[model samples]
Target: MSAAPLTLTVATPLRVWFDAVEIVSLRAEDASGSFGIRPGHADCVTLLAPSVVRWTCTDGTTRYCAVDGGVLLVSRGVRISIACREAISGDSLESLEAGVRSRHAEEDDAARRARVEQLQLHARAVRQMLRYLRPHPGGGADGPDGPGIGANPR
Candidate 1:
């Protein structure tokens, strides 16, 4: 008797990457290093790194995907599911590495820009709050006689 075929699924927060894949074996890399999986193997979980996950398809061809970082769960020694933030399919390993590096750099830049913008927003909000709390002499919004909550409106 032969081993059971794998039921593999790769998913992200947005959508499903691969719903079901039939494979005789799978090769994947994580923080520790690279490892392989065959059907009926021991069930375990891996903290995957930003690397490629490889497997041969049902059509007897190998496939690869670049994953940002995620969890690989091998359940019941038959099912494998990868939960990640992003997944990019690739035709080959070399091409996948190049594309993954480029995309990762772009993502890093975007994240840095977003953090800067968020900090700016927070700073602006704090300044506005301080202005309102300063208690101006005139009867304006920032004035002593203005609508400043908990302040003596003289």
Candidate 2:
């Protein structure tokens, strides 16, 4: 007799990506490495990195999901749950990979822009502070006796 299939549920903060679907097996990656899950496997929890998760259904067709890091929990040796910040699913690995790369590129660009903006803000703040500290253009001491030893103009 064939082993019972496991149920998979994937979700993000916004919505449920995949409801309970019966899958014969599953493959995912974590910091340690890739691992597989099947019915009657040990109940465990793992931290998944940004990688593709693949599973084979009872019909013998495979499906894929790209996750941006998440937590995977296996319960009762038959229930698999994945919670991620972002996830995209497709049957074609090539398309899935392309989509992931595009998403990552957009995120990187946004981060770079944010950093630039933050640096600009800091620069502006420093410039303002320096301007405030500087002596008045026409009134402040231009000679040593006025403000400091070097303030004296020859």
Candidate 3:
């Protein structure tokens, strides 16, 4: 039996899009750690972190996206909606690399380092999410199996 397909959509401020052209990635915090969702996926919602989001198209093409933080919703029909602060797609690799380098440089400062660390942590979380969302890259959802809701219980 195959899993349902997931429709993933990423949205951010229009201004950001105008400034940086790219699409962000999404991931699910499943009981198996993290898993990527493409077009066909089960219906459920999960919490997301500040990390890079990765997605593999049906053609076997993989894309990486960076996000600060956001929420992931998986509908019964396998549709995903991601609401995040900011997202950078693979197309913006240069800009994203610059941003990462800039953040890394800030690590030299004590105060700034802390802030940068926090941001980096968020970015890492987002990356993890992207990895999770990568189709079949990781094993089946292996974190905390549940209904895929409130994984990040507020």
Give the winner by lDDT: 2
Candidate structures ordered by TM-score, highest first: 2, 1, 3
As a whole number from 0 to 100, the lDDT of residue 6 in candidate 2 is: 96
Tens-digit lDDT track for model 1 on 1-154? 8777998999999989789778878888987899999889899998999878999876788889988889999988989999999998877888888888888799899999999999999999999788877755654455344477555546
Candidate 2 shows a clash count of 4
- Clash list (residue pairs), candidate 2: 143-151, 143-152, 144-151, 144-152
On the 0 to 100 scale, the lDDT of residue 19 in model 3 is: 20
Q: Estimate each model's TM-score.
A: 0.67, 0.76, 0.46
Model 1 CA deviation exceeding 4 Å by range: 112-154
Cand. 2 TM to true fold? 0.76
After superposition, candidate 3 runs with Cα above 4 Å error: 1-5, 15-33, 38-40, 91-96, 102-154
**Error of model 3, residue 18, in angstroms:** 13
Ranking by lDDT: 2, 1, 3
Candidate 3 residues 1-154, lDDT tens each? 6454445667776523322122232444433467766444567676677777676544555556677767667665556677677766664557677776666566567687688889999999999876544434233432334322223333
Clashes of each: 0, 4, 32
